[model samples]
Target chain A: MRNSFKKVYLLISVLMVVMLAACSEDETNATSEKSGGPVSAKIGVISYMTGPGAAYGEAITNGFNLALDEINEKGDVKIELIIEDSAGKQDQALTVAQKLMSSDDIVALLGPTLSTEMNVVGPEADINGIPIMGTSTTAAGIPQIGEYVFRNSIPESLAIPAALEKAVNKYGAKKVAILYGNDDLFTQSGFDTMKAEAENMGLEILTIETFQKGQSDYNAQLTKIKDLQPDLILASALYNEGAVIMDQARKMGIDLPFVGGNGFNSPQVIEIAGEASEGLIVATPWFGEKDDPKVQDFVKKYETEYGHKPDQFAAQAYDALYIMAEGLKNAGVADRDALRDALAEIKDLDGILGKFSFDEDGDVIMEPTVLIIKDGAFQQFE
Target chain B: MLGDIINPYHLQIISFILINIILGISIYITLSSGQLSLGNAGFMGIGAYTSALLTINFDLPIFLGIILGAVVAGVFGILIGIPALRLSGVYLAIATLGFGEVIRVIFVNWESITQGSIGLSGIPHLGRELFKTFKLTGFDPDMLGLKNNQFIYLLVVLILLLVNILLVWFFIRQNKSRVGRAFAAIKMDEKAAESMGINITYYKVLSFTQGAILAGFAGALYAHVMAYISPADFAYHRAIDILIFSIFGGSELIWGAIFGATFMTILPEALRFISDYRYMIYGVILIAMMAFRPQGIIDVSLLKWFKKKLKLKRGGSLGIGTKKYN
Candidate 1:
């Protein structure tokens, strides 16, 4: 029965291969015939819609959809948004980008939230001549790929130095210790930038430590930093690791204050770390509760729909789509080249996050703001 | 039926199914021999990186690079397999896992060669040439140009199907020969088989090498199709997923790998419709399937019913009754 089962299984395998080949040949025959007039231009947005990093992805989507909805309502030009889930995998990102680029209707692409995915899809974008503007890829070398690729979010190089400068000048902390996540590109890049800036500013670098992403224990690294007895601990990590380390640091009776990059912006970090997150300092381009009129409108609409405030990711993505929409309208040509030119020409556009313009390499030029967590409330530094 | 067959999305899906078919068949060799290996992902990584580097850096012909990639992966498999021949089952699985992890770490840390975690870019499109006809054929390149996605999908499906057919024929021929008896005896009891004068290590190493060759072939195809790859693409999680799929699809069957790959690839897409609840739903579904049908969905137990259903649809009740009896 087992041998028969194995033979039958092999037969089925043979059948499946035949069936798939037939399916492909059929598609090839179909591809030989085609033509269509452009209707409403559809823009395919590929992002990590669901995964370990789903929350951040969801935020980017929320911001993007908000912009799309507003633009469509105005009816200046008909634009449709088609979304594909990257699932935070490199292969999926490239596949989704290729599918989008192949379609004539899709004028632009909006995401692939992480820098790792950017590496996969960037080549496709450059080759296919599709404009792909990212929401939150802060990798140092992303913009150098091509003219078609643009990012509305400020790079970590710009954001980290401002945060470090704040820690040195405002908090008057001379001795600083650093703990960062090595696996994540954003965290690693932020840590490298902060380290370089700290050395340049003449701050005493007491200790440098690293941990992997999705880690729950940081007792060893935190204890090592505590022994250094630095005035401030700068942690560069996502919410999961940052929360665990902060909670453990408090339990270990380390009273030293903590400062972090954008990874600390999640409210879930507070919910997870509890009292440990109090007096935690972080920096980001967008704050959900900021009183700025543009930010206020975005926060109000987002809360009304999702029953929560927008995070920096959501704000950046929302701003990204709006920027792309504005570029599309300005370019007036729905094809790739015109959109690329229009995006490159963007200057002083006030977004929910900040007033931004693409630099020569298609990176957003914006100042980073520092925020303080006091009694579980995020407050912009005075 | 026509619409379903001709849809580019479905073609892409089938291409992946074919790739999975190749990997699954290769894995069947090891599974039938009662040896578990987790290092197939390593072979795949080597194949992908090798083919990608050849096509991008060396400007070699795509077909030649793909074959070379498989050869390179096969060589690495043999190299790794010889040292790992002493291990079995769980120990073998652990060794293979360690091997895969070491390769991934090296690919990430060795920036000078691999471009680090940033990954190599500007990989030339291999599939595009499949649609392009030479001037002798009187084909215009502009009008005949295939979208990279379509070309890759078709290319992958064609190559994988051809390789799979060849493998099936080879295995079938081997089954009737002395080699087949040797492999079966070794599978039954390695020590007993060894006492009977069969070289246990040779067959074991052969299984690992063959499996690695398929994995490498699949990886090479994937690199060209996607035009980019990173260390994370071949992470331990992916290795585990492939193994889980193999078991879930019934490792004993050559087609189970395809079943598992197709299931996993489309399963996530189907789960995507459920949005946030997809992962939770996936775990529950996997548990339920395993509990009810551990032999897999395509086992003999279901084959009888499936064949009957096919006959019923083809010629109605009259033919279906006769088919069922047969």
Candidate 2:
């Protein structure tokens, strides 16, 4: 029985090899045949727009879609967006990146958003001379992705300093406890950076606690930190863990100023943590309700269309798409080199997140926001 | 029908299937010995990262890098197996899971060596002995080289076929040898086998070690194919998914492992058309498959009986055989 199945498996493998080679041959033939006229502009998106990171993926797609809609509506540059899901799986991200690179239409790529996915997919983009702009992934050393790789999202290294500065200066918090999710790349990097920065800022790190991602109870970790009696708690975690940590800390009767990085900037954190997140402070690059007219218009449009206020994920994604489209428009041609030039030339374009600009390394040097959660609503700092 | 056969997407699908077939058979080696493994992904990751790193960072030949990657992954598997020998069942599962996680974490954290989760990029596209072919042809292979993924997929399929034939041949030989009986005896009842001088611990350790080696091969190929590796590629969830594939396909059936691998790999892609509903369907299908055909789709007599009832001739030259282990 095993033998026959093995035989079939072998047969299938053989058949697949022949078929795949044939397909590649066909694609080569087709591409070779279409050598003249205006080159079709290809915009590829490698996103986690499905699976465990579905919400974040959808938010990114929304950003990409918003940009495409505006670009296509104007009809200045002919562009085609070919999207493939990374599924938050690193291997799939690589596969999708390769598949996209194989297509001549793909001049540039947007992202495979998660830090891990970006890490895997970035190589292909660099090898193939495609520029990739990730919407949101704040892990340290993102600049190392490649010369062609660029991310507009503020790194955790930049984002954490703002929250740490607030905790040290505003709250007069001499002693701070560090809590973070271990499994998440962003959270881990943020926490580690904060730990170092906090120590460097002459603040005592009374307790450092870690919890795995997808964990519900932080009582053990929280209990250890609460016992340390730190003046403030700095948590580097996403909405679910953030909410749980806050809720659990409050329930445990530990009243101290709570601070977090970009992971803390989510409505779901407030919704889940409820009253516990009321006085929480977070450092973010962009807020849904900004003073800028452009940002306000976006918030208004997003709220009306989605029937809810957009989170930081959606806001950043929206801005990323706009910036990408602007690059395409500026390039005035479908050529990758030209599109890269267009991206390089982008300066002072008002995006939902603020002005969009790429440095030599393709990273946007954007200002960070320090927001406070006042009664369930995010109010900008004075 | 011809158009369908000639479609580019179909070819892509076929390529994917081939890749999965190699991965499936590689996974089957461990499963057939009644062991559960999650380290295949880790092995694949090692292969991918090592090959990519070698080609990109060191300017090594792609084919040489691929072989080195396989060897490296195999060595890693053996190393993991040595420590993992102390565990069994869920304990063993957790150990292997940790093993996979450690590989990913190392990949993510070791920035100096691995570019620290940004992924080692710009892997030269060629695999196995193909680099030599490229050198011989002097065809400016870098510009017109095979896509790394496609090459890896082909290599994986070819290796899988060779491995499957070898495994079948080995097992068939073993079926007539004392070693096969000892393994069978151990599988049936460990204490009894040990009492009968079968050296259960040795065999169990050997089983896991052998499984790990195959897993490493798969991992190496996968890494080369993808030309990238990150923590997310070989998470705890990945290990669980592989175990589920083995269990769902049937623990005793060799081909079941291959079938399970293909089904699991391609099922998600197929459901991708449904978007949100795809995961839901996948869950439902898994549950249904578990509830109804818990032994898997490869029950020999049942297949023959069903075929007879349907009055259909068994197509192809492949003959059905009885299960000696059972």
Candidate 3:
């Protein structure tokens, strides 16, 4: 029985190796082929196509493809895109980044969705001298990873302070409680900014609590916060946990106004929390409700393509693709260095997210919009 | 010739595989002694954080930092092993898993030291300063001027080769020594081994400590290679991955651990063409492998077949043969 099992195992191993080699070869061939016109450039698109962040990945890819299709149709620049899925893993992101960098033909790279994954791949891209633009990575020190790394997404540092000032002024919140996921770098950084801003605003912090990422139960922390009876609650959490925390906080009868960080900007928070999400205010760079033509066109196209309204993540990604195309057009992708130089020189570029520009550190400098969830929709907070 | 096959991309992947192989062997050591440890990643975290801090803060050389990290991890292993190895089966796995969580939490909450959730970045890569110093002294270090990734690749490969040789020698010596018999005796039948006057606790703790030291060493190398690490890198998922590598490769044999680590590490990258569905396919393959061959991808029969093909001595003892030591 063992001998037969060994034979089967060996056969399986050999079969897998052959399959892998064949598949990689096929991929290389597919990527190399260009239709009709000369392929002026090749760009790599990476995102979390699978795992918990699949929604964000899908939106980014959809936005990117929309832009790519438009550019290709116009025949101004024939840029071939090779998309790779990170599967929401750092190691996988590293592997994909390495693969993209070594291909020699890829002039620039984009996406990887999360900040943590970018932290893994950003340095490599910098070292290899390939410019990588992140669409949704908002954590601090990301652009500081190296010269080649850039992000269109505004960090929490810029967004949270504006939102906090609006919340404190509008609600007259005297005492506030802060809660955040301790494990995630994004949420933690959001919390740090919120705490600093709260102190700056002179809002008395009644209590500070933290929960692990992906943990559903926040009742224990909520119960403690309820007893503290803070006039307002500040939370730094992703959409899923933000929804749960809001729903549970309301259920626990802590009906104070909730001010959230950048993570709460997603419409899914409202969908998950239902009525509880009402009166919840958040600061974001992209507000889909904007009546601007460019914003409306992108949003309409995205809604038509994906059958869902484009959230902030999708909007930023849409702008990011346009920014990359503009860089490619200006630089005329003869070499990676020229493209890198072009990307660095991008300034005052108008897109869905207003006039987008990169600072010295490759971070986006943009005005943040404060919005409150009212009757299951985002409204400009007055 | 080897350089043609290994581009910078392949080099990074291969280096990670080497690190995982070291982790696999670490877990395999405990598995051989009939212990299932799910806390090796904790030791890895300790080693990574220690060495990274040492190099960044104390200006210690990378080699010395790695050694210190390994030593610290070995000491921590003994600390956890004493009480942790007392449990058996699923309970031991759970305990070790809890230990890993605790360590991760410490790394996260101990903000002043670990830099909180932001993680330590800009860790000096191996030989960056050495190459710079050589240039300053007017010595053309062109031959030694490997990029960080390339240098790390070579360093990890050398360490892997050295570790493999040491492990092989140790295993061979262990097989011939009385201590090895005690470990085997305990694994087969604890009550019988106890009656035969074998000190089970001492051997178990010793093996667990050794495994931790190996994991720590791997972690130090990983930190230097990647030039960045966070508590997230050493979370429970990593511990589980190490376990999977050991089990899938067949933990009974040393080569099984090495093969499993290499194959599994490369499998995801190989399945990259499938994109989002790749992980699903990977899950199916794992489930199928476990269902079909619970003993793992490598077994005694396969090893014997290789030996036969090579026309090696048939009478000599093999590290993973079915033949009982006694």
Candidate 4:
């Protein structure tokens, strides 16, 4: 019994020591802000550094870190960033947000990757009075969660109409079959926007079929669409499922031109779909091929550092960090409320995404550029 | 010194641990009767949504909302248990698992009610609101300039303590009662239990329903504490987590469930330093534990040793403190 008690005590002590070590590690990181700095802003970044959304998370992290490096090197204002991984889970996102709010003295929070997660954590940030800037959350009603919640990414409601109009006018699309993943907030909202836009554009509506996210088999949906013989298929799916759906539809001999939502704006979609991805059109806030020097510089620096072209997620994240920095400079005080007000007041802040400004609801107001995949590369659609 | 040692972050983690302990114990109630259920999370979801809607839409008091939520979930539990408890072993597990999926689908598709996948937010903080309702200005930590989370942590710990006491009492009382023997008989041999005039079906369903009620109670508290909950929060993943907690702690004793839930909840947060590799390490630890100590981290031998150390009397009750059964 005495021996067992000794073992238990030893085990507890080891655990306590490990926990203390972890706490101390965070403390060191927290205090590592450049000393002798007159003005320093501590920002917390919540990204999906692991899980299904890790790819986007990594891009956001890389973008933010790159911006951090450039800002610190410039030496105008020192900003300390503490990055936490939510792993694309709402509970983890909330936990990290709470940790950042209660423990760390953060002026702002950034990225969370998914709108679903943002919806969960956004209100908490609002209650805590911390400004949470979502870089990639584009679903509806996100900014409506709280005044403190903000997103630099353009919403599907604003971007999808332009793309639908382009599809109708440029391609003479009349009959379109709509396919969307009903489970995801992003894709479902995308489908809603597309459906609304299609109705407004006076396009013939074919049968609308829904599938769950992560479902690979689309033969049943495609077969049904094939019978309808629509001119185009409107797909609202992430790159992984979008690639499969396009490939499957083509293989099934349903060679209709596809118009996709924001989720289809990825190199992975083209790489996965291969020849099938040709002529697939999407509307996005950021197009890497833009001749604007700011866009080119960001793409060049990102490509040089990450060994690949920065996707929309990266570009938006890069701009998001810059926006936060801009807000910090504008507020001139490292206070949460001041930073939030400053972020809300942001207008015509030109960055990679072009003349970015936050509307009254904290949603980005910007014109989306239409692009189509040709010869395995995204180009401006004429 | 203790207050200085534990910061707000640690308090938050502790509150989560407490909530999970409640979940673990909820699953343990069903496992005690040898009914392997996987629908506790569905019941949790029902409780969370019900309580959240009540508080957010109707302006009901937080505690009242939580109670009503649990009661509503309990009614649904009975509804599910009547049909699901008819099956046994893996078949019963599958039925419950299917029920959990159905609940998820309903939550996702019923956009009008649940706000769909976008999820419901702006859930009022329970601790601050409860303090305000009671007019206990002095005891209200939020009013006293302490963080709202600290008050919530204290509330959660208090609830955990109350739950532990209730579980201990229920386990002790039930073990001596006729219901406990009937459950043991059904688990040991359904035919024999039937021959002994034990109503196997009734006991099984009762055990399942009771387990669901506990889970719902935990869920209601969890929703209020977190101040936000999504349907995805109570998916099959959460069911698996609850199952792991009960099994890893050894379902035979309530203390086992407590230890299992507390350890598992805190382990992930503690392993956060590893970041991406944390889940990998967690899987490894689970495998190691199962391989080495299949009976669980808290087994009969440990309980026996503990009882001896405390000089507790033997054989009065068949609850966690005693070693009458494995």
Candidate 5:
């Protein structure tokens, strides 16, 4: 047997040695802070850069990169980003948030991609008084973490109601079947919003079914919905499952207008569901076909830069950075407390997402464009 | 006596290591008896949610919440252990794995209480609020330096250290006692151990409960430190990770858990220098370590080497004695 007391002492000594060895390296880190910008901030980004959610993270990064170029060229805010991949895990997100919070120079943080991550990272950043904004975290109750927490992406609580109302108005439907992936926070929150809204609008509930994500067989749930003969289907699911659910419903010879929440705001639904996507409807704060010159300019610049059309994820992230720049410029200092105040006070900010403002809860206040899938492409729902 | 000026980044990492060490030792308790129970992660979940909810809903003291959390998990350990008495080897592993899944499903489906998949966030920052900011005030750490988070992290580390010391004493003492010998006998041959009047059922259930209690505490500590948790954190992979900690560290001794957890936790941070390739490299390193030292980092040969080098009247639990090695 080993000596317990002496081993404990040895453990402490070794840890102390590690600390001393670490301290000797001089914790002075040279930042990428450029000279001569009235608005200077170092922002940290935690994203799912290499996971299944990498598309969202990559788009956000691309958007930020594009926005940074424009802002730096204008010579107003000089921002440096220390981006870390969270790999879609909350623990990793928390770790990176702590890492970012430790540094005195990083004035702001952004984009943990998903609402679940923001649920973890948001509070930590808030306690530390760092302003953290989510570009694509659209689930409900994110900003409730603290005043420092903000999300520019429209939450499902708002987006779902709008889509459902539009679908009701168009289809003149009185009864609807709601389907959602039960295992995800994102989908659950969306489903909650849909249920509340459907009840509020006095639509009769036909059936509600829950399915697990990554499980392609939705026959069990769809058959139940099919039997109800509901006028429409309200779905809250990621693209992969959403597409299959739609495709399966169509194959089962039950074609009904499908109203989807924020998760359906992607081209993958169309790519996967094909003809079933024709009547698919979703509400979003952004669309590429807006007739505004500014929108065209953004889309053109984005396409040229990345060789792909910038989707809502890229657009929201693009607008989020611009919004941060505005907040920094208005704050007139790099202080986080001052930045939070300035961000809170922001109103009538214009970007690719159009006129945006922060509500009292730091959630985005903006009008969303309701869109419908027509001929395998997103078109304005008239 | 170097001045204690450390960044929150490093402090956070060290905190994780300490928390993981608690978890490692937790599983080590179960493994010490040669029982490979995988339900520890589920027990951890039970503890984390219980503590988090108690503190969040009832405004209980953080300590009370944590203790209550652990106690609730221990209760569950008793429940699971009763059923586990009939199974062994892979059957026990599968049963425990199923139990873990059952716990996760409960957390997910019980949305009103568990918050579903979105998880519970903004749980009180325990250490931060618990302790007053201490200063090496005369020192020149002007991070408003080390005045706040550093003290918080230090206290959390100290808590983990205290837990560690307590476990070391208990485990070291237990290892030499009649109960420890009974465990060894049971592990070697259950029939023979039972024939020797060892009371196999009692000891087996007792080990499971002890594992649950430690895991529950680890869970409480993790929830408070990170201030966030979800069903996802305590999934099947987590159960596997808890098992890997003891096995990789060398299940032959308790130090194996300590050293194994420390090395594994730090390995990821150390590999951060390699960026994205780090996880791949980490996998390779683990594979290499296993290939070379399947018995673990603290095998019989290493202990023998330590014995020869220390040259003491008798090497105790810590492997450190009053004698000078050099």
Candidate 6:
């Protein structure tokens, strides 16, 4: 048995050596075949398509796929999308990013949903000189990763101040309570911005609380917040926890209007929190109720296709694909560096997200519309 | 085929398989001595973070960082093993699971160094730095008539591959030693081994420390290859994966761990075509594997059965022996 095992091992080692040589030759042939006319720029997306964060993934896929179909039909500059599910884990996201890089020949990458996954996947794509754009990664320090990384999603550092200012003025609230998820980069950055902006406006912070992502019970945190009796609540959390916190807070009769970070832009908060979602406010680049012809067309088309209205995730993803399409058209070739430079040079373009453009640091520069949940859908705060 | 092998993405996967093999063996070392730990991932984290920090902060050589990381993990193994060794079976598992969580919590809170849950990226990768520091001018043998320039990257991968293969072979052959027997004796009957003056405590701790060192080394390589390390990477689930690599591969032999690590590492990526439902399929396969082969995918009994079958076929074909082996 031992001898047979040794023989088998030797056989495998020999086979491996032969294959390695064969593989190197195979690569030469492949490179030589790439001298043809430009093909579609293959863009890969890493997303939280499963696990607890699947809602974002579902919306992103719907939005992008709808956009992809329209863009491919237009035939200006052809594009193909391949999305891999990260399941909200950093390791899985890294593996998927590598897998896409190795096998698919993706010209660019889009997202892995959360900032944590982007934190892992961004540098990898950048290191390999792959143009990676983020649709929803809003944490601080992402643009600082490398030259190849870009994000269309507004970072919390910019969004939270606009949100706090709007909510305070509209509600005439004096004292505020801040609640956030401490473990995640998105929420932590949002909380930091919220605190600074709140103090900047001279609003007294009555209390501050935090919870980890995927934690079901926010009762303890809400109980403490209730005790503080702040006139208004400020929260930075993903839709999953944000809804539950609002639900439980309303149940506890703390009934003050809540101002939130980017995570609350999803309509799933309305679905989950139900009646309690009323008076919840969030600043967003993409508004489903926008009166613009482009925005209305998307909202109507997305509703017909998906049987529901587009949320922030859907709208941003829709815009993301369009942005990439424009970049592909300008570059006129499906190469990484050309697409990256083209994308960087984008000054302004009309989309669902308004005049979308990449700033010098590759972060999005756009004004946000502060909207409050009224009746059911989000409405412009008066 | 050769082209696919040279793809940086495929090379990365190959590296992960190699790293996971060491991790599988890490768990195997403890299990062979009737010891159970669900904390190999924590040890791996220790090695990764320690090595990563040393390299990032002090600009130490990668090799030195790896060695220091392994040492720290080994010391931790002894410290943890001494107290935790008193418990047996499930209790030991629970205790070690707690150890993994504690390590993760520490990593999450140690924001200054670890950079907290967001982790640190652009971590001076091994391939880039190693190639820069060491020129393989003479070493780049255009082994199969490939271009020397193209083969440089392959040469680095080949070196790492050869080293890992040797390590796997060493573990496979190491079971014949006296220490291996001591482990076997302790597992079979602890009291009997103690009666024979084996100093069971020493042997148990030795196995634990060995497992930790191996995991730590793998972690150091993992840190460099992934170029990113986060607290979430070493959570309780990852420890479960290390244990699964041993159990699913056949914990009975060292070969089992290697097979388990290789197969399991490849399985998820192999199922990548399934897209959204791949993880569900992965889970289903695990369930099916456990149901059909409870002893694992590789074991001594299965090998012996194969050998007997081979012998019968050979004898029958040659018409040399008419032995009626049922």
Top-TM-score candidate index: 3
- Once fitted onto the true fold, the runs of candidate 3 whose alpha carbons sit more than 4 angstroms away are A1-6, A19-39, B1-5, B127-165, B172-176, B312-326
Give the lDDT of residue A300 in candidate 1.
90
Model 5 chain A: worst 10 consecutive residues (lDDT sum): A18-27
Give the better candidate number (1 or 3) by DockQ. 3
**Per-model C-alpha lDDT, please?**
0.75, 0.68, 0.83, 0.82, 0.83, 0.81
Q: Which residue window of length 10 is worst by lDDT in model 2 chain B?
A: B1-10
lDDT score of residue B109 within candidate 2: 68
**All candidates in order of DockQ, best leading:** 3, 4, 5, 6, 1, 2
Q: Report model 4's interface C-alpha RMSD after superposition on the true interface residues.
A: 2.8
**Local accuracy of candidate 5 as per-residue lDDT tens digits, B1-326:** 21245666666777787877778888888776768899989999999999999999998888998999899999999999988867988888889989988999899999889888878876877676565323333432233445555667666777777877888789889979987887778788999988888899899888888889989988998899878888888999888888878888888888888877877776655554445675686678679768966887776566665666557544564676655553
lDDT (Cα, 0-100) at A148 in candidate 6: 93
Q: Give interface RMSD, every candidate, in order.
A: 5.5, 6.5, 2.4, 2.8, 4.9, 5.4
Any runs in candidate 5 off by more than 4 Å, and if so which?
A1-27, A31-37, B1-4, B132-146, B312-326
Q: Ten consecutive residues with minimal summed lDDT in candidate 5 chain B? A: B132-141
Better of 2 and 6 by TM-score: 6
Ranking by TM-score: 3, 4, 5, 6, 1, 2
Residue lDDT tens for model 1, A1-382: 5575566557656745654454333112122111332224667788887777787788788887888788788765556777778889876676566556656657788888888888768866876788888888887778877878888777878877777677677778899998987655677777878898889988889988988767777889988887889988888887778888889999999877787877766787889988888867777898777778878888899999889877788888888877877787787757678888888999999888778888999987887788777888778865
Residue B311 alpha-carbon offset, candidate 1, angstroms: 13
Candidate 3 differs from the real structure by a C-alpha RMSD in angstroms, to one decimal, of 3.9
What residue runs in model 2 are displaced by over 4 Å at the alpha carbon?
A1-42, A172-174, A199-202, A223-229, A251-253, B1-27, B35-139, B142-178, B188-199, B227-232, B248-250, B301-326
- Candidate 1 or 6, higher TM-score? 6
DockQ of candidates 1 onward, in order? 0.17, 0.17, 0.52, 0.41, 0.37, 0.31
Better of 1 and 4 by TM-score: 4
Q: TM-score of model 4 relative to the true fold? A: 0.91
Better of 3 and 5 by TM-score: 3
Query: Model 3 lDDT vs. the true structure?
Result: 0.83
* Model 6 alpha-carbon drift over 4 Å, by segment: A1-40, A102-106, A171-175, A199-206, B1-5, B135-156, B306-326
